[model samples]
Target: MYWPNCGKGYLGPGGLDNYGKYFNCTGGVAGYIDRAVFGNHMYKHPPCQKLYENKVYYDPEGILGTLTSILMVYLGVQAGRILNTYVNVRDKVIRWTTWGVVTGLLGGALCTFSRDNGPIPLNKQLWSLSFVLVTSGMAFVVQAFLFMIVDILRKWGGRPFFYPGMNPIILYVGHEIMRDTFPFAWKPTTETHATYLFMNLWGTFLWVAFSIFLYKRNLFLTI
Candidate 1:
């Protein structure tokens, strides 16, 4: 019962609003009830089924989800700015890494407390918030470490290299290492990774070398 209040593209995934848009919302997002996702599937949620016929799909008390998303996004962007503003590799790297790990922990905590339309109701905002928090947090950490590595190694032409993020080197080589090496690893077969949570973790490793080059020579990838 995930009725999206946002019009146009934000109206949930596979909906008419976002069919061809670049951003692809998955079947499941953080804090959103099982109904928002699994209602289209066979996920067994009696509460969601019972509420599906109602005019309003989401819980009446679910406004907190949007608020939480706003807060997480704000905090994440500020955290990114703090890390990016630093000139020193050590300070920049440490701050970003800490932000990434800490935000991930917070997102995990939300999962523990979230329920599918029980006394507690999860919604789109919470799901989107968790994504932003986790992504930005991980970005901070990865950027720091990558910066440190590039600072140590002087091969990247004193500038950052920001392209080929999901190139064969990463998507093919790195992922095989995860699948063949890690025991019982839930590696992604077609998607980013089965452990979708690690998307930023891997993304950081791929782009840090380039980012450090950018930082060292004052080059940035801007639109």
Candidate 2:
């Protein structure tokens, strides 16, 4: 007797490993975003509120997510290559800016195309190729913008952002661990979305402030 809902066997043959099952069953990134943005009815599992499994959604294991990450890394490598190879500062700035604009436009086009007529939609959970293009392109544009502001203008305006970038591991870990703790989080006056949204913004500001403090003290954690 072939039981369709049998244990691990039910994971099927689409690279649906244990982690993927967790994402699919528990309503991983895709589920949460869909629920919040599109008002989709998300199947919430008690104790673990962020995940929901629905076989109909597919790509539960996030294979594409990993692949898109590699593409992002490649973009970083290309940036490094551009910096190292370019002799003239003007050339470097122009090249990086041009690449940023091109990629950003391409990403936007791809996203639009995918939305209307596509092999796959731009899904954050699936890490679809369209999603990769959009994010990586935006990343390129942001990098170019910073390059122009800090490197070209020789301005100290980017210092705050730089502080967090310098010690990202520390900032990330600290934020995750302390996000729900006192000061970072507190009882809201009202149980409304606005209240929670303000709390989130407050948490972000606190981290930036903490990063500034660390920067002033010359306390940097480098791996």
Which candidate ranks first by TM-score, i.e. highest?
2
Those runs of model 1 whose alpha carbons end farther than 4 Å from true positions after fitting are: 1-69, 113-128, 155-161, 164-223
State the C-alpha lDDT per candidate: 0.46, 0.61
> Residue 63's C-alpha lDDT in candidate 1?
42
> Against the true structure, what is every candidate's RMSD?
13.1, 9.4
Model 1 over residues 156-203: C-alpha lDDT tens digits? 543334443323354444455554344324345544323454754555
Shift of residue 75 alpha carbon in model 2, Å: 1.2
Worst 10 residues of 1 by lDDT: 46-55
State which candidate has the highest lDDT. Answer: 2
Tens digit of per-residue lDDT, candidate 2, span 1-223:
1222333312222224355543343323433334445443433233122222234333332443566678878887888898899888777777777777776667667656555334334655556566677777776667767877787887657766777887788889998898779788877766565777798888888888988898889999887
lDDT of 1: 0.46
